[model samples]
Target: MTMAEKATDQAQRNTEIVLTAMRELFAEKDITALDRYWAEPYVQHSPQMASGLDTLRAVVPDLEGFSWEPKRIAAQGDLVFTHSIVHGWAPNPVVIVDIFRLDDGRIVEHWDVIQDLISAEATVDGNPMV
Candidate 1:
């Protein structure tokens, strides 16, 4: 394969790994699994809270049955953008747009915007916003 093709393959694999890890972490609430995918200096930005990895670790326990499904993903160079539907108590289905910056195959930074999916008008094509 060409260099560009190889890079694309690597990026796609990395994205899948990240997504899978996130799903497992959410489903099982296993904070220790985070170390396998998240960088030491990871930063996360959320609608309700913006904090570092430690704070997120602490706050995860308060959340009940959090889960997400990625609707789309786009990646360029070191950055990957994912649009997903997040489900939890705060909102039945929250539309979330997350941007992840990866370094050395690990997620080092993340920023996200979450909006509650209330009425059908809030989405497009009669589907939840993602």
Candidate 2:
């Protein structure tokens, strides 16, 4: 494959890794299991989560029923971003955009924005966020 093709393929793989880890972390709530997916000294930029895997491990719920339905994942180099909908953890379904930075196939830094899911009818553009 050409160099450009190789880069695209690698980016796709990175997107897959981020999506899988997110599913396991939020949907499965397997906090400790993240050791396989995250690098040491993971930095968190979300207002809610603090830095490090230890802090993340302490806050994640070890339960089922939660779900993260990702609409899209974009990746370039070591950065990956996913747009998704979350349910069962908040009072209402929420829309989230998560950004992750990876190193050697392990996620090292993270950021996210969470917003209340809006109704399709309420949109002026008449298009769904997803």
Candidate 3:
């Protein structure tokens, strides 16, 4: 395949990997998916979580009512980013952008920005925050 074709293929695969991992871990609440997709020394940049896959494995099960609905996803090179609406982790639903870096098909690093969802009335422009 051409270099451009290869890059596109890799990006698609990486996006799929992150999407599946997120669905299984948060929506389905299947912790074992971490073993399949997460690297041993997983680096987490989100302030709420610590580095390491063990930390994630330890926290997911107790997260009652947790759910994630991905609005969109994109990928470039080794990085995949997703915009999602999440519930049960905070007092209100949250909108989050999560970035994952993958190596050899397994996620090795992560960074995220999360904000509580606000109603359209709450926005100065009155635009819905989806």
Candidate 4:
């Protein structure tokens, strides 16, 4: 394969890793995904989460009625970003931009921007949060 093709393939793999990890952790509430996809010394930048995968293993199963709907994803080089809507962790649905950094196909770092999904009526421009 050409260099461009190889890059594209790697990007796709990275994106899939992010998506599958999310599905396993959030949708399935399976901690095994952490071992499968997360690297040791995982760096987390989300204010809500501590800087390691162990915290996730402790927290996910207790989340009542949690649901994740991934709206979009993109990947470049070693980074993947996912835009998703999550429910049950907060009073209102949250829109999140989750960025993952991977090395050798294992996620090593994460950062996220999360905001409560505002109602369409609350928006001055009438734009949806999704």
Give me candidate 4's TM-score against the actual structure: 0.94
Q: Predict model 1's lDDT versus the native.
A: 0.76
Q: Write the residue-wise lDDT of candidate 1 on 1-130 in tens digits.
A: 9989988987787787678767767777888767887776776666566656787688777887677778998887777888887888364778788898888888888888877876667556666354
| Best lDDT among the predictions, by candidate number | 3
The TM-score obtained by model 2 is: 0.88
Lowest lDDT sum, 10 consecutive residues, model 4, at 48-57
Evaluate all candidate structures by whole-model CA lDDT and list the values in order. 0.76, 0.84, 0.91, 0.90
TM-score of model 3 (CA atoms): 0.95
lDDT of 2: 0.84
Model 4, C-alpha of 33: deviation from truth (Å): 0.9
Worst 10 residues of 1 by lDDT: 121-130
> How many pairs of residues collide in model 1?
0
- Full candidate order by TM-score, most accurate first: 3, 4, 2, 1
lDDT of 4 by residue, 15-75 (tens): 9888898889888888899999999889999888898888888988899989988898889
Clash pairs for candidate 3: none
lDDT of 3 by residue, 18-97 (tens): 98898898888899999899987899999999999888888998898898888888899999988888998888899998
Q: Stretches of candidate 3 above 4 Å error?
A: none
How many clashing pairs in candidate 4? 0
